[model samples]
Target: MSDDLKVTAELRESFGKGAARKLRALGKIPAVLYGHGTEPVHVSLPGHQMLLILRKSNAVLELDIDGKGQLALVKDVQKDPVRQIIEHIDLIVVRKGEKVTIDVPIHLEGEAAPGTTVNQDSNTISLEALATAIPESVVVSIEGAEDGTQIFAKDLILPEGSSLITDEDTLIVAISIAQEQDLGEETDEAPAEEAAPAAE
Candidate 1:
């Protein structure tokens, strides 16, 4: 993890919806941290800074909780449905070199063979990797792949230390022939009298 991901948080003493709304109004986000059989600690984080850091997936935060240092992983986020506002966040404690299981997004590197339609069945894959060294995403290349070609989860090439946690048989991508759309030219050529008789 980079030092840019580090954040200084304040231990929150208040709880409940009203307190949370007040915190948000003050440009702070309400959050809870827990793991390793420890009691959950409620904290308030800088909203703008956290928003920027969370743009990347699986963000690991090196936190300063009232002068005490702790490492935590972004576990889950709750947002407002209409406004997309960050309502709350859940953090799980982690240590350096600890292996954590998380889903990594899949990125396609190249285009398939011309005229072939590419169908992506899975958008992300599960991986078990060191918490501090988690990869941002897994790349799968389809350059020059022909129609009827299929790529499965087992075929993915992962980062050096990461291991696949998803089932091996899961389909990732499938390439097939693209179907042409009908232009309705045939319907225009039919006689009006014949079409009326068929409708009756």
Candidate 2:
């Protein structure tokens, strides 16, 4: 389940690349909050804390903005390609018990049968769960699975109060026998007579 962490945010008046750079220099991250039929609010959030909170998937936050508490869901995060530093974030407001559709990662546990390889076809599956109850990831066991075994989306056991939103026939994991290619045999060279004739 997603845990809501409290964070303090200050309203930001500056905009554009220059302003964002300044905020980053001061260890603040620029972000926008919008939802619940209200106008978008621009603010600056603490950089280190924001990065830590965002390490979890589908992070929820209880924002304290001037003594007014607001519930927000992590919607999007943009980052620098080389430095991998967070650039900006977009948060969507949500209420308790609100149902939201999100994609959760599939984690395969255990090993398949010997001489077989497990191939994952889908990395994520969509689910409809409560805003605060969204799972971090779904775990599927492949223990002792034999070759030609297939696990489909319809067969997934979802967490309580969650329902699958992805297609039922989606292929999640497939187990198959490992194929080995045989290298061609080396041929013997018909050798030295031609070199000796050329030398003569």
Candidate 3:
């Protein structure tokens, strides 16, 4: 794991909504770590630092729990609906080189052939990858793709250590001829109708 992914966490003994609110007031986030048949551990993490790290999807954190190191994969995040503030987080313990299944965002690159519009059917796909080696996202290039061209999940080129877990037949991107609107014809017809009403 990179040094930037490391965070020092404090074990928290408090519970309930009141306790969680207090932690957030102090710029801390409450999180639970559990997995591998171990009991769940509750801890508090720094708010600002976590927000920065979590901006990227499927973020894995190297947590320092009282000078002890542990690897955790971000499982879920709860946020305030209106404020969009991070409320709590769930982390799953993972071992080095362990394979974990997660969803990776899809990123499109390049433009399709001229006069063609590209449509993405799915925004993210599931993948199985090493806990620490998960790719941030998968890229699908539509460069020079002609109309009627389609790309499926099976056709995607994944990162070296990742394998696609999504259904093989899922459509990822489709390129088609752009539909043109006949605005000029509509305008001409509207003026004729108005002129008829005026003559009557």
Q: How many steric clashes between backbone atoms does each model show?
A: 0, 0, 0
**Residue 3 of candidate 1: its Cα lDDT?**
76
lDDT for model 3, on a 0 to 1 scale?
0.94
What TM-score, computed on C-alpha atoms, does each candidate reach? 0.91, 0.88, 0.91
Q: After superposition, how far is residue 122 of candidate 3 from its true place, in Å?
A: 0.7
Q: Decide which is better by lDDT, 1 or 2.
A: 1
Residues 1-200, candidate 2, lDDT per residue (tens digit)?
22438899999999999999999999999999999899999999999898789888887888988889898899999999999989999999999989989999999999999999899999999999998888989999999999999999999989899999999999999999876532212122234544677888
RMSD after Cα superposition, model 2: 5.1
Error of 1 at 116 (Å): 0.7
Task: Give the alpha-carbon lDDT of every model.
Answer: 0.94, 0.90, 0.94
* Candidate 1 displacement at residue 107 in angstroms: 0.3
Candidate 1 lDDT score at position 9:
91
Candidate 2, residue 156: the lDDT equals: 91
| Native-referenced Cα lDDT, model 1 | 0.94
Error of 2 at 172 (Å): 0.3
